[model samples]
Target chain A: MSPLLEVNELQIAFGGVKAVNGLTFSADAGEIVSVIGPNGAGKTSAFNCITGFYKPVSGSITLDGKDITGKRPAVIAATGVTRTFQNLRLFPDLTVLDNVRGGMHLYGGQNFVDALFHTPRYRKSERFYTEEAHRWLDFVGYQGGRGIPVRNLAYGQQRQVEMARAMARKAKLVLLDEPGAGLNHSEKQDLLELCRKIRDLGAAVVLIEHDMGVVMEVSERVVVMNFGKEIADGTPDAVKKNPAVIEAYLGKADEPVKADEPAKAEGPDITEGDS
Target chain B: MSDNVDTTRAPRRIGKPASRISRLFESRQLGWAAFAIAVLFPFVLASNYAMSIGTTAVIFILLASGLNIVVGYCGLLDLGYIAFMAVGAYTSGIIAKAWELPILFTIPAVVIMCILAGLIIGGPTLRLRSDYLAIVTLGFGEIIRLTANNLAITGGPSGIYGIPGVDLFGLDLSGPVPFYYFCVAVVALMVLGSARLGKSRLGRAWRFVREDEDAAEAMGIHTYKVKLAAYIFGAIWGGIGGVLFAAHLSAISPQSFVFLQSALVLMAVVLGGMGNTRGVVVGAVVISLLPEFLRDMGNLRYVIFGVVLVAVMVLRPQGFWPSRAYEPEKLDEARKGKRDGGPRPGAPVTTAKGGTP
Candidate 1:
């Protein structure tokens, strides 16, 4: 079967700058792939292009062998691609449960007429929506009050809500942008396990993360980028040892150390590159 | 690590007395109370002037509810909502006069015209956000009124007259008392429908769009289509109100559907509380009746009205009855598990803060 998502020769530019240039990647069902790179590496930009938030200058994005390039975000989302933003984008005024129900918008069994009249179908569908929202919130281990506005939750709790919202889509492919940012070590570990669980549920999971620990622990395959170009692609062990990956993470030096030696230094170096 | 987290979630609170008043207003009892008052008002007053004012207030309530769909629920700023009302009134008025039919019989045609009007105005303008949308809708409102003023079928500036009263099941509802009750029933049903729509899936989508369009789109809501749906619903409600407006007056005129009328309807939505149906109804009643009650003030009634509105805004920017945001509580075993010493079955271990396994 064709991969769940495939992008080929994707190029997008903003005025004079090429945010993503001829980047290519593919993810399959039941796989967890991480895209890790230095800041301005165009990871988020590429994710935006695939999700239809940003129109690419030239390329093809196909989902299950169907071209979906440049489609509206809602249209692309309807085809089973769901994502979380780098910043927590939970509706601040909406309750946590409502925020998650938002992901289930396309899974419709009722329309405006049913809503106006409060038909049995409307009640049934709404009940299902609420139940599923609670289920996903539970799955993500959100301990905050589901009835309160998400703005009331701590930043880390809000991140969990955003993940639950994305997962609530029940999509075939899920893209998480910096899912581990601002998370404590324990939360990051939980996120790792959640990624695996998502893959086990027969969905493709792609994440852009700065936390090397998460990228290395959770990703079955890793793709590294720098300046909008894919510089390395392999298993975590292989990518860690790639000379170019090391050079990109830690600026060029007189002597190239072994992969294990620079592992501790990689985190700070990546943080330095972010600014 | 969670000690300073402020995890003791407190129930959201407004001011003490305000919260109590809001709770009272939010209850189903308020709807019943309003309905009862509407039913009993004519009996107590009985005068033609009082009945007329009451009937007009009922129609105003319908107008406010319709505008609520677009402005309050969907967060579309409509400056020319009166245009939809005009479309409905004119379509029904012309059909009733030309066909010699009761105004009630022209409802199907009125609905179609309102939908068309909604599409015509909402299609192009829904793309523009905020202030631009306000400008375009204001233009459409004026354009609709001007077209009616110049059209012979609409009787130009004089508009259509001698429009027959609404007849239901051979019962002539032309008398003031009977018509007032009829308006009450119909307006009650329409208000109920609008409130029901506010709780539906589409309503949630509207709120989502209102809150964050980009996030709403990312969640698979077609923001444009959702917005257009709000516009159409608003148009239909306004159109139906127009049918009642025509029936109430037995005549239609361009002078009635002016920009100030639209502003008054908007003021009702804002003053009552934008998304709360009960508040909108209350706002409509207050806006429509306050002037009648202040008639002794002569021309200064409007100035007082303006001052009162400004005072209300200054005191409660959220309106009289702000829409309540709620979440349905399910069986929360996790919270239970926290209190007890045992972990809930199937509960993820990661919920324990600092327990990095």
Candidate 2:
């Protein structure tokens, strides 16, 4: 079967800087992939390009074997790709259930006339939306006031709400941007299981994470990126042993190893001269 | 960890007393009470001037509710909303006079013209955000009024007069009391329609767009289309109000569609509470009737009205009847059902190990 999402030779630039350059990756259904890198390693930039937030200078993005590159975010979302921002972007003033219902926008079972008249169709659709919103909130193990505005919830709870909102989309592919950031220990645990649950739902899951522990524990495969390019792609064990991956996270060794030298041979040429 | 969650999750209700008061106002009983008062107003005050003012206040309620759709529900600041009203009034007035037909016969023309007006004003301006949008709409309002002022068909500066009263079926709704009741019924229906629209799926999309445009877009809502829908709905409401205004006055003029008219309608929406239907109605009534009520003071009345408005703004920036921001607890109960038990008491705290599988 075709991969759920495929990004090929993607490039995005701001002025003279290439934020994401020639990045390629594919995520299949029922798999958890973690994209790990240092700060400004362009992981988020690549995610943005994939999600249609940033138009890439050049590349092709296919979801479920259909080209979706450069589509508007809403259009891309309708094609069964949903994402969460690095920063929690919950509708702060809306109720927790409303925030999750945001994901169900494409589920249009009622129109303006139905709404204005309060027809049976409108009532049925509204009831379905509310029930689905609650189910997703519970799926994420959210233990907060469902009726209150999300702004009233604690930071960790807010994160869960965002996760629930993303899951509520029922998208074929889910991209979680730093879902573990700023989360406490127990919250992160809940998030880890939530990610697994997402994968188990038969949706392809790609997450950008900084926490190596969570990344190692949850991801089936790890794709390491540095300087806007992929440096390593393998199972968690193999990627961990890849010297280029080690050098990308920690600074280079005193003597560069021959095995991983090809991956970083042009690093000096690409690195701009800055102290 | 569980203990920490419990401590932070204290059941803190928001604005308990205020919500209770709002609930009372929001009840169907309040609607019935207001309807009864409207029904009995003619009996208490039989004077022509009193009846006329009451009719105007009802029309003004329609205008404010219309503006509430654009400003409150959709969060689009439209300053030229009066243009649609002008379109409706002029279309009906000209059609009724030139064709020698009853004013009620012009309803279809009024609706079509208002829709065209909505598109003309909203198509380009809705792309602009906040202040820019407001400025453009203000300009559009002036443009429409100026065009009406200059055009001969629209009666130039002298304006259109001798416009006939509405004839519904066989009954001539021309007299002060009959017309007052007619206006009351029409305005009440319009108000109910607007309120119902606010609770629909499309309405939720509007509020979502208001809260966060990008987030709403990411959720597959086309913000532009939703905003346009709001503008069109506002135009329809205003246009219908124009029909009532023309019928009540038996005349139409460019002066009636001035920036001040738009501002007053906006003021009603803001003073009452932007998103609250009941609040908007109350605000409209107060703004429309306060000057008439203070007519005994003559010149001092204007000064007092201005002072009162300013004081209200200072005291309650959220409006006299702000919309409540809470969801019902039905979803909470649904969630609890899935959890087997709700809010575990004295549940053991569990730590998440970094390397736990």
Candidate 3:
């Protein structure tokens, strides 16, 4: 009955700089929530906190009313949470099918013993992995060679494989960090449709995206942030018209010559290479 | 997705179909043929030196296969792998002499001791990255050998002696010809087990960890535990190799488990190609027997062996038989028998280049 993922008063700081300060948000099953912010607004920092990549100094994160703050990343993911990185963080040397099978690790029916001995259960589980891999790739409309190393794929195809890998988790809550970045116009449209399809599959979808067109068209709700704090939260239409949200992205209306000069652009893009 | 976007697909070269020999290498029959040749080798060469070389080569194969699990599959650099072998040999040798039991019965205790050693070393080192792990393991390996060197329980520098030969229900397998067969059978089984593990779900998890640790963890693979598994499996294989070593020599010594020995084992893995069982096996055989074949060159045999290893590595760094493992779409559909083998309408054309396996 309650929201599936909830974050309250989450604060994380790095040395002298506070990356995310007292940020709060929540989402329920079968809903799409988008977080839009300027480059240094701590959207990714918040994501890193929730996914246990970085331990927050204060506040808590919960899934299905269970506290998950400070848990290990693997532990957090095991509780039905899956995400795609802003950059494609795929096993580049592995086949596309093997990359997707990575998500099914926790649910694999056989263990090391079965693997060593090649038991019937091992064969069945492997067949399951392959079939599920194919199914997820098809669902994402991936038409690349599933047997080749993903490094050889085009950048957009690589993103599709990353999506297929994340969706293969079948997690209850899916967080997509800039799923539309580097995508062509048509590919962006496919991603928009995929977001809705993901929501229709009874999972909560939280997206962090900079493409305003995709964000406005696909997101049911949008939360805006600037300088590590939430400035506004509402429907996409309402958030778009919010004066503060506009100021955070552009600058102050009246006298905005050089107030926030540098990061009036995109901020702290850690994934700068390996497209 | 629209098919109009050319940016979504990388143009690929469509190579000719794989050769017949390559297809043979891809099948299990090749493995069986190699095993058959090993089994029939004794018939062709019955000399004591030949049998000795044969058993030692089989043991080397076992050692290389085990190291492949850690270095090849999981990408963990282990510099002190021989320590596991030391633990196994000493555990079994000490137990056999003190308890007056057959060395065969010491298998269980040898496995347990190796596991404990694996945990001790892996617990601290698996937390670190490869460079630190390599140094730590190199240190621990020396620590293990020095401990064996000083311990009264291990007979100090003299090492344990009079290790009983493998006994099987009143049948003694300690004789040269019989023991060769024994080592061959056991090593074959172990090598097969390692290969089986390579293609399993757990095996895939290990490969994932090797390729990208962070991505693996984000996908819910406990990277630490997976790495520990690699360490433990490597230890067990090395330990079993040790037991066989003691049985072969009828004695044990710290000198047998040295850093150079570990390096040679690792070299076999690298030369054969990492993560490929067939390649490792071939590498082990070449590394172990090349010197004997070059015996006519006297001490120059060592120089020739080194040159050959360097040449092979430089020429084919990917290994003699690199892993080319993946099920093709045509093969998959043919196996399924559900769809008419025709290409579906609107399906994008995708090509598979190079080797097929």
Please name the candidate that would achieve the greatest lDDT relative to the true structure: 1
Candidate 1 residues B230-273, lDDT tens each?
A: 99999999999999999999899999999999999999999999
lDDT of 1 at B50: 91
Against the reference, the lDDT scores of all candidates come to 0.85, 0.84, 0.85
Assess the local accuracy of residue B14 in candidate 2 as a C-alpha lDDT between 0 and 100. 69
Better of 1 and 3 by lDDT: 1
Superposition error at B6 for model 3 (Å): 20
| Model 2 score (lDDT) | 0.84
| TM-score-best of 2 and 3 | 3
Clashing pairs in 2: none
Error of 1 at A115 (Å): 2.1
Which regions of candidate 1 fall more than 4 Å away from where they truly are? A254-275, B1-23, B331-357
Model 3 / residue B126 / CA error / Å: 0.0
Question: What's the CA error at residue B97 for candidate 3, in Å?
Answer: 0.8
Ten-residue region with minimum lDDT total, candidate 1 chain B: B348-357
DockQ of all models, two decimals each: 0.34, 0.32, 0.37
lDDT of 3 by residue, B1-357 (tens): 224323333234222125677666777788999999999999999899999999999988999999999998999999999999999999999999999999989999999998899999999999999799999999999999999999999998999999999998989999888999999899999999999998888788899999999889889999999999989999999999999999998888899888999999988999998999999999899889888899999989989999998999899998887766454443244346665544332234243210010
* TM-scores, one per candidate: 0.91, 0.89, 0.92
Candidate 3, DockQ score (0 to 1) = 0.37
